[model samples]
Target: MSDRRSEESSGDEPSSSSISDEVWEQFLQDTERDIRKSAPKEPSARAREVTERLKGRKGEPEGWRTGPAWQEMNGRAARRRRAWAVIGVPLAIAVAVVAMRPSLIPGDPFGSTAGTDTATTPLPAETATPTAAPSAAAPGTPTLARPFAGSPALRWADGAAGIVLPKATALGAIPKDRVELALQQTRKLLVDANLNPDVVAGGRPRAALSVLDPKQPDVLDNLETSLRSPSKTHDPLFLFSRFDPKDVKQAGKVVKVRGRITFAKGKFGGVAVHADYTFVYPVVRAGGSTEVTRTIVRRVIDAELPDPTRYQVTPGRLTLLRYDEDAGNSACDIHDGYLHPQFPSQAPTGSAAPSGPSIDPYDRSRDIGKQEACGTVSRT
Candidate 1:
């Protein structure tokens, strides 16, 4: 038993010594590895060479740089900033507005007046001149006594005085005095047909008819027939400015007129007077409404005085050559001897439907060309 115990003790001591040695060696190795990993490394060869070169180089003098001055650079930078502020601000705002609401932008910034680079096409004589716009200044509301208020006719001359006669000049064989006589007679006839209160009130145009030469074809007969029995074919309203007494009455005494009387050589070796006039009459409801309305009557007439020495013409009488008429704010198709003015509140009656394009009555820049159908006026 003593020999066995000795052998075991010897084996245990060597085993313990071997384990302690192994553990110590392992710990030393791990510490060495950690130290190597944590320690800073040496500079590369290229880095050391660059450092040496930089350290040995001589520095530039105070103003060696070749470029714009610092102040100029600063100015450029400031200008850039200002440019950004000017353009970027509005751009940012526009973007924000578009994002919020897209419809505020106009579909067409320019209107119909904007023209293209294409050549301009020729327009008709009547359409060549643009229609004159009404007064931009606000006018007073029309009253019973001052019906011409708010109307273009407010600036027109009153009665026959507005019918300005041109300077009498001899035409062909007609003398100046004879031309003057014809003009005076023609002026009287126009006054009788239009300005005369009796004729305008639907009474017989006796003075007007008496001045017309009875020998002329369809002159006196047609006028008489139209006055007696008016129809779409024969309307006396062509030459005469008559209105229905029962429906309306003159609102004021003033009858505004504007026109030019020009004379030229006649067809039958006489003097021809071409009169183009527009008359404005203020009328109110005869049934006692104080509201006022204006009737615009435009007459374009050609009357001639024949040379009694050569032709078998009546003395001191005028011959009707050609005539054209247009009435605004009046009924469309009614052919009675009186004008049927449409009031502001009144809709046209069954017989008053317009068949032609609407026209502006205040536009005196164009001629009343041949219109086959009744037309509507843009305004009263």
Candidate 2:
């Protein structure tokens, strides 16, 4: 029994060994299939895992599953991994370079840094300095220095200083010869009482002669009539008289007369003279009260005769021929008081004579019937 048992056991042992080998072969084939399936097509951690698992299975049939094919697969995977590493390293470096490139641009990175360089820089040395302009003065104020201060003959009066008058020698130079000649000729005419001789015989008179004041109203009347009349009744030299006989006969005589003279060019190309005279008379009131009275006597003397129609002697053309003792007298009385004597019975007769405003003295005289009634009450 023992021997029979031994032989049977031995036979069963070969079969068992054969089965174990077949099982081992089957496991290796299954492992190789799993490795092929799990191996990464590209390099990855999964492919490394499969390679390591395949290398651990070294006891399997060498030619069938663990030889050149496996090696070639691992080699290809390593090469693919190396290539990806090279490409990935370069790509990361390229991305970093592109990101940092904008910082290297020309302008300042921070906005505050702009214009700072230009602001800190110094200006060029050749630049010119700016000059200041002069300031203007207020209106109506005089300048600091007078422009014509060097001139000796000019005199400034009224509101302005430095006013120039060629006639005044202090302000300006004047021809003494011409002034003397004019004065001499005027004196001769007054003293001689001759209208026949021309005042300025050869050249035109440079200055005009104006009669400032006459002694009597008759003097002015005669002068006006002689100047206006076609036939010369009295000598023209009589016009130069400073006193009138009628004035001496009527009232106490006065010595000097004061008046104004304005000169203009005459129609005959000579100096035209405008003369105004005021006559002063002494009057005695009640109780021996003596008073001096002034009346205007105006006359216009032109070198050339004027046409009656073209250049009529209106009341406006005549001015006060004498000084007004009372500064408050009406301008019309000062201008037209001389016309009183010419129209003696004008008011009582009610004649429509051209007359001006009457003075209070004349009006009282007319009412009291003392003097000749001269003018009517003013309508205006």
Candidate 3:
């Protein structure tokens, strides 16, 4: 029995040993397969060796599985990656465009275009043609276009020469008939306060006629009031007679007369032409050495009168005389019949002859007496 038992045990041992060997071989094969699959093939030899040494050990925890939950999680991760990629790509493109866009801009708003050299350009010249010149005046002929025809002031007539005397010949020298006629007219004008034909023939006959009748006390009072009034006494006749006729005729006939006219210093002074006709009258001796003066007396006569433009006349025969004696080289002669207020009257008086400074008709110098200085105002 012992022998039979040993044989059976030996056989069983052999069978058991074979089975253990088979199982060991399968384990080795499976471990080799798992190591080959898990190891990285593209790794360097050293890295592969390291990976191989760690292979077939329990792998790191992998929760992903082939199930609905794994698929959904994979899908969400894909969408997130895709969204990040989309956002990052657009941001990069935008950054690049913004960085380079200014360099690509054209045309400066304030400055000139590039590649030009000059800073400024010149303006073109005018192409219009010139006009023709005006013609010149003839030589030696006086041009009436001058500011003053002949006198300094704008005169009614060209000059004083244009003035005519009452009943005097046009340009002929004053004769006895003309003087007598003027005297007679003067007397008639004084008597009737009417302008005679001779006076009218002169430029301002109405001025001489405007004189108040000496017999009419009301007229005299009015005249006196007008003379005294502060306002301008605008009697045309009175102004006409007061204006120096000689000044108007200065450019024409130059006549010297020994006569007197009333005068005032300031503006409204009634001046009349007065003359001693007795100076020219023939004296007759009566009753043996008892000299009785038989002289045809007359008021001052309006001789060769001046142009109306030269004198300032008012309706009441108020004459504004022009006596610029200073301008006439201090000559006191009555060139325009301007009577100096300071000069004594030529009429015979009871007192001895008054002696005073001669009045300059044209004395416009600043040094003339206060009365003459005030009278020599320019109408112009």
Candidate 4:
């Protein structure tokens, strides 16, 4: 029994001493960490947050070590946290730096513009310029992004409607005077709207929304809405529609149609056109019970529509103005969606179902706000 007691005591004494030594070693390392941190050096924002989070001393006195093993584990956990804090703080800064200075990156990081490439396909020098035919750009006019597709310019007007493509084939086919061109372009846009095309340029199936840019389509839709209510004043649209139910309704049949373009005073190239559209409505009677009937119709409709120069045009970007606004290089200048919402005006109400399938061949992408006009957007 004595031998066994001696052995038991011997084992217990060393085990307790060994545990105490390990505890002391951990405490010493913790003290060294505290000492290293004692000096007042500037801490990074993240490091400062970490320091406040883990506030306490290491290498505490012997009495402080008398708690559960979990207490020791917590101390180790805190030291690990401090190590990560030092590494993570710098990593966060690097990412922010990259975002702000995209120019520092080697290539196009955000997006690109359109029509700068052969994609739009410029006209060849060998092709003879027709009288007053549309071309890339006129002498005084700003350089256009693209050129006309081909000649005589109106397959629809001459071929379909039996109306000749206006021989305005003079001065880039764009009149020299801003007001004249504005009225002329407005007349053409209305004519195009009546035809209900995807997008029109010089009676040629050329540019998409860019030819009209952004505002012209809005003018057309708004006019259609106004003319639907004949009681409302729209002398200009009626004149432009040529008084045909098909033309004025812009949806039915007609006996006759004709019109002329007028102007509203404005600054620079920002002039508005008041089109005087005139037409006759053809009424047809159906049924053996009803007697034959004929009707004569003449109504005048008016609305202001924009010319290309009315909106600010950069190399690849087209800026839009609101109903009561002038186009400028301000934050208020928007460019997106047909009749896009301006700052004060929220998005115009629209039903998920369209009244009719839009003539635009392709849907405009929701991705807008591109700095360049249109280009191949991608990473280098």
What TM-score do all the candidates reach, one by one?
Answer: 0.64, 0.23, 0.16, 0.23
List, residue by residue over 153-216, the lDDT tens digit for candidate 4: 1111221132222323223323446444544454454444333333111122222123244322
The residue-by-residue lDDT of candidate 1 on 1-380, one tens digit each, is: 00000000111222434346577467556644543342111100000000000001134322222211111111110000000000112222333333333333444322244344111222112212334533211123469866876465666677877877777988866789989988988898899999999889999988888888875545576677878998655577767889889999999788988767888887555788888777888888898899787777777777878766555567788876656676666655456767776565554442534445445555566656444445544344
Score candidate 2 by lDDT. Answer: 0.22
lDDT of each: 0.58, 0.22, 0.22, 0.23
Q: If the candidates were sorted by their lDDT against the true structure, best first, what order would they fall in? A: 1, 4, 2, 3
Better of 2 and 4 by lDDT: 4
State which candidate, 1 or 3, has the greater lDDT. 1
* Candidate 2 C-alpha lDDT tens digits along 1-380: 00000000111222434336577467556645543342111100000101111111244322232121122222211110000000122222222222333233234432455334222232222112212211111111111122111111011111111111123111122234333332333332222321111221111111212322122223344445434441213222123212222221112322112222333433321223332222222212223323222222212222221111322222112212211121101111111111112111111111223132222221111111111212322100
Report the CA-based lDDT of candidate 3 relative to the real structure. Answer: 0.22
Better of 2 and 3 by TM-score: 2
* TM-score ranking of the models: 1, 4, 2, 3
- For each candidate, how many residue pairs have backbone atoms clashing (under 3 Å)? 0, 13, 42, 34
TM-score, predicted candidate 2 vs. hidden true structure: 0.23
Clashes of 4: 34
